[model samples]
Target: MIKRIIRNTGLLCLLFLTIAVSQTSAQESSNLKEGKVSYITGENIYVRFASTDQIENGDTLFIRDENGLAPALLVDNKSSISCLCSKLGEHTFKLDDIVFGRTVKPVSEVVQLQQELPEKDVNEQVLITQEPTKESSRTQDINGRLSMSSYSNFSDEADNIHRFRYTLSAKASNLSGSKISAETYVSFTHKLNQWDVVQENLNNALKVYSLALKYDINESATVWAGRKINPRIANVGAIDGLQFEYKFKNMFAGIVGGSRPDYQDYGYNFDLFEYGAYVGQSKKTENGFVQSSLAFFEQRNTGNVDRRFIYMQHTNSAIKNLTLFSSLELDLYKLENDKPTNTVSLTSLYFSARYRFSKRLSVFGSYDNRKNVIYYETFRNYADEILQQASRQGVRARINYRPVNGFIVGASAGTRFRAEDPRPTKTLSGFATWTKVPTLNASLSITANLMQTSYLDGQVYGARLSKDLVSGKLYTMLHYRWVDFQYVNTLTNLQQHIGELDLSWQFSKKLYLSANYEATFQEQQLFNRLYLNLRIKF
Candidate 1:
């Protein structure tokens, strides 16, 4: 049965890919339209229109202010009703500034207008191609996803267990142009035949990922209330109070005041008040761009200082075909002799760089020296505690080559070491992908990895076949993997096999459904999982 399923999946992949490739040219047209700048916060400008369905990342829009059309703005991201834009050059803009998408006027009309206008005013007339107009009808933009999953485990020595989980994420904005936006995410999980435990752990099962409202006070400033995560200072995680940001040319500054979530269950905790401020600068160089930010945070518990730290992050793409990113966290407060003292200590550091030698070749490397993440409430086992104490300091390097169109080969190596350990864990991997298989219109990838650790060694190999069934409407993928592990001290060996199948269907422009099934086998043990998700966009 498994073989039959695999064969059928392969046939479908090839058939779908063939149709998608043949219809690619017909889907190249766009329906983008003009939008107006509703508000601006720091370098992030919010442009709103009737619908953002046709807008896409990297699209350019001309911005017009009192001084007429200024520089263009690049659409960095978009939601259902708004597009987040960044300035492409040194152009000053204000609130309610007009923005226009691409529009073409008839050559004959342009010539007539120019001929009738004075030479001095010809340029001004030429600039009046199109202006952004506000939509008469106000509509609230809403989008979200709901997902459910089930897991079952089978073992010879232990009774079978089953678990169910559900997750929800939603975002709503505009709400009749009141300039209000809110987003939220929550999840719940429970084991089968464990109603009592589920009731007892209800609080832990439900987590409010984000519940935030954003309001634009003016052109250059905005405030967010409630829990929100800011990408500018994402290393600080989520903030539970207020966030304010302002922009000045190529520089930006922001401040956040909030309380950290409860460490135990990720719930609201008023006693863990925290506040921070950050400054960042960004500029485009001749070849690329550079951005950097620095922030300082202070956290207090019960009105007493609990932690103080400084974070710095920087990214540079100023060199052609190359990118560099680095960040560091330093603790400013430490406890000594049961007394708090100001002492600087590096807590975490990461650096990464990627360089594309050419269209067909690229290399990337990274180094990370950070302590392992630990959840105090969940650290019940000795292994978990030991792993927390073992700092995960590692370095990885990878290279990829594409000798021909739709074909790629890559290799990578990495190692992790701890100060207390004598030997480091090393890993090596290689992979190949062929999107164009001669006359077959399908994609296939194979990957293999070998790992050597102080206590054990392992090898893993996998393959995947995937294709888009109906252009952007439907997709399918099948994957299989084999793993072998050998314990160095115990002289024990184990092998496992895993297989997965995934399917996604875009029922319409606003609705989507996806499902996944996975199974694993190891000797007499078996594990299975099923997942389904539904998403909607407005």
Candidate 2:
């Protein structure tokens, strides 16, 4: 397996080199903007950019890995110059790592009335922004970022640990202003004293998330070869073979054929072959836009059908002050007691919507029902339920109000339940932020959360202060949180205090550095972690 991985990597590198040599002067200019990862907590990652002018919630962000410009982050919330994002897959990221977001959408009147659409419509929306240009196709336009970082952990009960990581991301779109384009993202990581682990299995320390080449046949059609995730068929994951698409007016269609990556190590696995086709339409109304897509897919293991399914996605914001999006997947093939069966089963469903009543007030809600996707020929031994009920079905709602300039408040509630579970899980959270504190000249935010589950009941309170020490060049933040919980089943209580400090510095247009430290104090023990990073962009 290692030999095959190395051979495949070499072949891809050769192909990329050949293309690079042939298209030295074919690049064109781009409007892509750079952002750096600043903080990661729970499932959210925060990024600081020059400005959020053209960036929107639900937009996709790219990162560098061994493969190429793979989709890594999904923008969930944004302020003037910062965004809150969530990981798209299993990819891990570090502070000061660079991310790219293109300036595509123009501010529309509908934006004042409703929130943005979901990720399912992100690709089509970006495509709509790529109108044909009159400039020469051979002008060079290139952008990318590279970085290195280290992480350290100290604990009272365990030995100290350290790790280092390096990442590279680049993109040459419309290379030399021609029809050719290339993208790649790659990363490598290793422990402070574990060189042998990397020497024995390089895949353990290296990851290639994306690498692909693209060519535009015309303004209405395009083709991509190599490993890439098609924006239109993103739910299908990355395709390692070929993808072709054609657009007619506002309607589009595409086909993809590829092999799934190795399930264990994320390496090449041609034996896990798959293919699918999708069709969708996008239309811009005077106020907003609407898009919808449908797809059919099948996968095979060793030439035998392993799974088949249908995927559907839709988003609409044509109505003023209202936006809606939904995605669904239905399994079409199943196996029972070693017998082949063809039955339609609902595997996943998600629907969300948001409405802005006015500039100061808005509300959002969502529902989710998901089950484990089955791959017949791949995992016959893992045929039972392993996922928790809380992840399978849930509902949530939130409301935000900006009563005055620089002052914003929001509250949210969520619940999860199933027929087989005795108690329903519930959570309530609220936050208030003052963009500018009168005496401190800094922003302050306070938050609290109350949560109850079958096993525990908890309440958390937190406060944070952030400031720019040297305007655009330096910044700092301080945070503290207290957690208190009681185990309902065990009748025990627990409490802890956590504190954090973050600092960032921009030395020049292409250089940046950041440091972060955190400590957790409990009644019996204390834990501390430190991270430092240096990044360069071109």
Candidate 3:
């Protein structure tokens, strides 16, 4: 009986090897195809650029950044694009003339399959299985502070300031392989700063600022509501939106809220709210898999008119230890009041990659191309020009290393290309930090960047911005706290510095105290913020 079992196991192993090899070979052949672009549902487009690339489904990708420099890829679908390729960590592909950019609706729910265990004698085969354990899939963090602080500024106003900020969050696992979570952020400030009304309001308001829920249908899929970071649409990650994330095997997908349109003159400025959706995939291995994502979003006001954005991306790793990725984005405005509010198509493309020559040294860079085609309106207001949405391409590169835990150092540089203009702005920056101390932790970071930026209208020019972020804290087993610092220099020659010291102590379970002091500097004016807070269980 044992002998028979051994024979059966050997046969199964042989079969598995054959299938795995064949799958790899087939993917390699597809990636080797020269000059062809075909979107494979669960993977990236099969490419055969220059004839010598070996790629496969789900392989890790490494390539150059856009501008045909660093490492990156193009995977967006809204903008019309041709002649593209990607780095697949150890392979590359030439995007042939094909359908790589297009809109696709959501598909049916993914079917859940039961795990299957093959019958085999334990003595004959070695089984490598991941350990299963209970997961703390849910968590809640509370930030409370208590202290005494005072603020004195350029003005003789001796108004006392008190402030408080708090947050609560929770999460739970879902049956569809998804998880659900929610949170609320609240702030309170009395005797607010008069310099920036909006900033002051935000700093002093004690209201539930945001709430969110997440639904995961599978290991690689999700849909969410409330507030989320808008990815590659309208603005980059900072713009939060009501959104969704989907991952089909290796192919990718998403949709997020877009920017709303509002006019300040003639009461035209109505807070414009935008929404978007996108899909794409990426390769993370050397077997020639691909990485990409396509997305779309829109803004709506009563239904009379709206705006939209489409984005796509693709990336892979190639030879020479190079990684590459690229992206394309489009912005469109429409009006229900008329035909389509004026429309502008802005297309952006960039690529980047990095190479590690040693354990602590490596180089990376990226290039961008942004072109905005306006259908009609071009105005002459400096604010309009400076604040107006901008379209430009640029390049960015960085190199860094870590000699040990809690410490890192690096330097980076970047340059921009404007669509409406013909000049480029460049910049360079460097910084370092360390947090090796236990119980007490601290770190400092600084960066300097220079490039061309636009105002409300559309014209690109040179400017420089520098930033410094730092944090420090010390505590024992019963309590702990930290201080925060920040600084920013604008290209319009506007400069500002901010410093804040805070402390928090937990007297015992369910009770705490916190306090903070802040100072701000802009031009020749100086301002400050002060607050103290406490919490206790009844």
Q: Which digits, one per residue and each the tens of the lDDT, describe model 1 over residues 1-538? A: 6635633543353344334333322111133354556443322355654455665554556643221333356564554445555444323454334466544445653333212111001001112211222342334545444556565655565677776767555555554456665566566777788888757754456566666667756556768887777756767767789999887777879999988877887767778999999998877666656777899999999999999999887766677666667778999997899898999999988777766575456666778786554442231222212222322348877776767655667777888877675578887778776654455455667887777777767777888766556665566768887878787789678787888787776666545666777777878777665656564433
Error of 2 at 110 (Å): 9.7
Q: For every model shown, what is its TM-score relative to the native structure? A: 0.70, 0.81, 0.43
Model 3 agreement with the true structure over 1-538: per-residue lDDT tens digits = 6635633543353344333332321111122122223211111232212211232211222221110111123221111111112221212232112111112212320110001111111011101111122363433222211222222333334544432233322122231233553332223333345436445433233222233355554556566654333332323332234566655554556666533222321111224555556655444343222445567666666654455667665544433345455566677765557566556677566555545554345566656564432311221222223322221236666666656544456655665555664455444445443323343332223333233443211212211111111111112111111211121233344444545454444455335454545555556765665445454321
Q: After superposition, which runs of candidate 3 have C-alpha atoms over 4 Å from their true positions?
A: 1-164, 174-210, 215-225, 229-248, 252-277, 287-289, 315-325, 332-344, 347-352, 368-394, 401-410, 416-426, 431-538
Instruction: List clash counts for every candidate, in order.
Output: 0, 30, 129
Candidate numbers sorted by lDDT from highest down: 2, 1, 3
Candidate 3's clash total is: 129
Where is model 2 poorest over a 10-residue stretch in terms of lDDT?
Answer: 378-387
TM-score of 2: 0.81
